[model samples]
Target chain A: MFLIDPILNVCERLGRRLLMLFSIVGRLVMFAFHALRDVLVPPYYPKLIGQQFINIGYYSLTVVGLTALFSGMVLALQSYTGFARFNAESAIANVVVLSITRELAPVLAGLMVAGRIGASIAAEIGTMRVTEQIDAMTTLSVNPFQYLIAPRVLAGTLMLPVLVFIADIIGVFGGFIVGVYVLDFNPYTYIQQTWDFVQAMDVISGLVKAAVFGFIVTLMGCYCGYNSGRGAQGVGAATTNAVVSASILILIFNYILTQVFFS
Target chain B: MKNFKIEMQGVKKSFGSKDVLRNVNLDVKKGESLVIIGGSGTGKSVTIKTILGLIKPDAGKILVDGQDVTNLGGNDRDEYLKKFGMLFQGGALFDSMTIWENVAFGLTQGQKMSKKEAYPIAIEKLEAVGLKESIAQHYPAELSGGMQKRVSLARAIARNPEIIFFDEPTTGLDPIMADVINDLIRKCVSELGATAVSITHDMASVRKIADSVAMIYEGEIIWHGPIEKLDNSGNEYVDQFINGRAEGPVKF
Candidate 1:
């Protein structure tokens, strides 16, 4: 009886898919609540947390540090060329420090960890799930969330800020090297400029962003992996989905945080 | 009323739109070995799992020792689960753990026994299962299929639980290995005097292990009797499944 019957049916399909999307989000939120709630509770596994801290923070230092350093160098080099046109080349130090601390360091480190650690968490958990190790834990009277997930989430949230702080320092140092060596800037003047221009708020905001990013990385990994489908192909899909979703969420949260702080 | 170790009255469950278990009733006496036999997906495993509290039934009640476990959670659930042990279909041994650690998992993790104390007990259980103590340090991946099944069996009975559940205990094993596992199962159940419930399709396993047999079809126990009366059960569904007949009420 309706003229839009065909269109309405197509709309129903789209609506169903959208409903599924929200359902997944709802599931993720509930998962996060359980994971975060247990983070500070007793029966805490210091042994497992200590292991995850080392794995997430200590092992990741080299790659994150290198990325920060190289990005800083490139930023300094490019800004010098850009500012030289207007004879504002003196602003190179300020720009490099601001960009690295406010956005670049946290973002690059987050993306890198998302690729490396997210895929690892997802793959490990997915394999455990398919092989029935998670079920085995349940049967053994162990809470899988407390034993498997809480430690990693707590470590990721607590450690990433520290990693990003290190990245901020190494990044500024990298800028210093390039500005002093390749750009023929005065080392003394460059230091003075960086020190003078950098604000505490800039660094603090970046560290906050890093902490949130770290939570996203580990959480997506565990969620995707825990709910992974059956078999090797299923594990592979979970790994890919974890990395892709974590990276996307990082970018979205970055913009939102920037709007809150800067706009 | 006889004191049954475990009992389920009208227990029912479904997965989404698919009703896997429908109006199932079962009972096991203390120290009795009851094997539930059926074709795959006929609710045999689901029936046992429902009793284990792994899957909550959508309807009816599940009782253990005359206590209702329908709404158990938190400490109550943990205490309930501590009374039982289960061997999964694929052994479900933690690959990350060594053989002894896998056997002693319940003692150390659930009961909080010191590892030093649990390790000796673990070695003893492994020895009972005919596995050498030398393999105690080896990983599950290093073991063969039959060895893994034995290790899983060892783990199941390790805690000396009051009740034990074996899901397809002899599946995925060669004939000789299946017979060996059957003997071990019989020995474990007899020595511990535990209430044992097993779900299996292997007829040979049923004859060797079951003191009483219940045959499930379409989520219902269509026929149940002692093992000696099984061949003459006269129930077509039970007859068809036991004979493995291609032409029967069970659809391919």
Candidate 2:
């Protein structure tokens, strides 16, 4: 009983520390919401918006699509092998479409994009902030918030859904190719079964998750960049923090949104 | 003898408990070139940053043309900013932009000039700074350090600002290139009839460019007078800094 008491106390302390970390994250999220509020109020920079869209969105498509496609193919193969025991190999299409659309596409896309775009944004802006270029912009009649933050946040929110939609289609196609050619399922039957199980809710839920994850990724990037301390080491720290925090937030938000949409 | 264009009276700034600028007072006449000489980390950059309103002062009155500009905001701040130009220590050119585009950035973005209008003006400024028309399409990274400094100087004067700030404009250049840059700075400032405030540790630049010199020590102006008086300023900090002595009041 005495040993058990000490173990329970340590668990309580760990739980408390986790809650404190969560609260800090929540405050940062609230600060991001305010920054977004400032963003929409305008004196907009369309040039910066277009640039970031190309940078964060267009540049990210190949990686996200490739990840989704390979993940879908592997998932179909695994499911086929597992269901073969019961002679339920026909369930491969249902499993591939459902898993890719509901979970894998959005999560993988979000994480991959987070690593690529989030780190770059943080590092670029973090270097600028530390080098006093951000301050120079302010003194040159440009608002750093309006010029820097608005376009990035806007691009992340608007572009991720489109990327995720493309990822979804490509991923499902990957599964189709694997299921039909490799596993010898009839093409028509595979497509039909895929359509039968995937309702509009699944696709919509994934897109919603993408949009939320995009916001988390970009907000974390910009926040870390903006608050980066003075020097190369500071910028590096901000870049790493942005990727890690954005990835974690994406996963956590994925679970919460999943519960809301599914449960 | 001319009217003062910008004035900082008892400006004080602190980051937490560490006071950076302490009771800094300065005045720049309408068309005079004022050089501030200080050792590294003596708040030379911080003083200029405060006047630019990049770092808000904890206490001070900064006046431009008799208006208290310390607390200006929004369009007012932007309007005030248009009157000034700055040449940053690193040139700070936008990496994504061409040389001409970087030169014309303020004219296009802040002034809302058409690219067609801004392009010719950018070319003219580039040429004025001894850069050829062929180099206009090249990016900042393609330029040599001296060329980059010339490009930055061109950008600084692109708007024909009433006031210009130069922060360490000749730091990394060879002696001949530094002199050329100093000469360009003088010619540009005089041609534009702009009041220039320069902060540098380079005494050569100070001698070449300054109408009046101010020596900053421990975050305050310890000595200020005409450049002719710099050789006989008699202050220990000024003497030590200008001579580049290792044994001085300003210990590294």
Candidate 3:
């Protein structure tokens, strides 16, 4: 009985922590649903939407493009070295393009954008809330959620897929450059093999993932910003929470969607 | 002339175990400027926020133009909000926007006016606040502190709202700039015939802008009367606050 006491205490503590984590996630899910419900019924702001499109889409292109390019190049080099040892060097092109276009392009682009754009959105809105700009907007008969959150979320959903599409093309081209030029593979054969193995489902699946990742990123950012407490410390805490939550949710959703699509 | 513009009754707000506002009651007549003076953390800002429905009171009634606004939500709250304007303590201008755009934000975004329609009104408001047309193109970051406050003031009056709130309007300004701002606040409120409610500890601003004054202590209105009667109000808290003495009921 004495030996069991310590074990039981540890179990109880772990159970309590898990329950708290679940409650927090549940509250966030409920908040996201409420935001979506509000979004569907709108006195929409086209100008604000356009502004956020530039913010979430155009501004994020550089980081996502750079990440995809390097990732694809490295992937090709590693695959070529491994396949050559097995006298399967011709399979390098197929591996690189299929892996990049199907998975890395969307996931890497999503995560990079989540880190860059998600933190900015949270900090910007959190500062506004702390400084009373949101209240001022309310006093001027403007709905802060409609003006701020809706536009960012809409832009995120629309823009990420476009970004992922661009990343997919760029990443494949990167792989091609590495394979044909550096690895001394025949350009014609590499292109043919890549085209043969890459299917429409792969591209479509990547786009779907991009869209879901966008939703998670924007929702997490807006939620943290809107609920930020008071002062500089509160805003700083919100920014950190936004990035961590978005990154985790992106990975979790990626796993679930992959299972549903492939399993 | 005697109509009540804003009124509060038995407003009580508590944050956790600490009571910030304790049964505060007050009134402001039309076309009058009321300045609320209190020490830091005595709920001066909370009182105003409650009236604007930014913070819901734990127990109270707030009335603007005879309509109870304490529990209004959605479209009703939005409609109620249209009649008010506020100048935040930090100016709170969008950093990405130019001075003219900041001033015209409500006109263009909230009222659905085109840029062409809004820009001219924004320039006009800027001129009224003594800013040149050239300054209109500059971002808030480019402006000096005094200029930023003036731009904020212009933005607050852009919609010609009937009720205006200024929260610590002159807290971090140089004495000369603070005086200039106080004069501008007075001119704007009177010229627009707006009912103004300001919360501040700046005695110079209070004397320059307020027609009436209320002193909040421990979340309650310890003293309230016309500005002319403030010196002789006989309330120890009011006397201590206005005189800037540390040896009174309000401890540092």
What is the C-alpha DockQ of each candidate?
A: 0.67, 0.46, 0.61
Which regions in candidate 1 have their CA more than 4 angstroms from the true location?
Answer: A1-3
For residues A1-263, write the lDDT of model 3, one tens digit per residue: 99999999999999999999998889997888777866776779888889989989999999999888988889999998888899998888788878887789888988898898888999999998897788878877788888888888888988999999999888888888998889888889988999998899989999999999998888888999988989999999999999998999888888999998889
- Candidate 1's error at A242, in angstroms? 1.3
User: lDDT of each model, Cα atoms only?
Assistant: 0.91, 0.89, 0.89
User: What CAPRI class is candidate 2?
Assistant: acceptable
Q: Give lDDT tens digits, candidate 3, residues B1-252.
A: 448999899999998799999989999998999999999999998998999899999998998988899999988988777788899899988887899989998888778789999999999999988999999889999999899999999999999999999999998999999998998899999889999999999998999999999999899998899999999999888888889887988887
Compute the TM-score of each model's chain A versus the native chain A and list the values. Answer: 0.98, 0.90, 0.93
Reference-based TM-score of each model: 0.96, 0.90, 0.91
Ranking by lDDT: 1, 3, 2
Candidate ranking under TM-score, highest first, comes to 1, 3, 2
Which portions of model 2 miss their true places by more than 4 Å? A1-42, A86-90
Q: Is candidate 1 or candidate 3 better by TM-score?
A: 1
lDDT of 1 by residue, A196-217 (tens): 9999999999999999999999
Clashing pairs counted in every model? 0, 0, 0
Candidate 2 clashes between residue pairs 3 or more apart in a chain or in different chains? none
| Candidate 2's TM-score on the B chain | 0.98
Q: Model 3 segments beyond 4 Å from truth?
A: A1-23, A229-232
- Give the worst 10-residue stretch by lDDT in candidate 1 chain A: A37-46
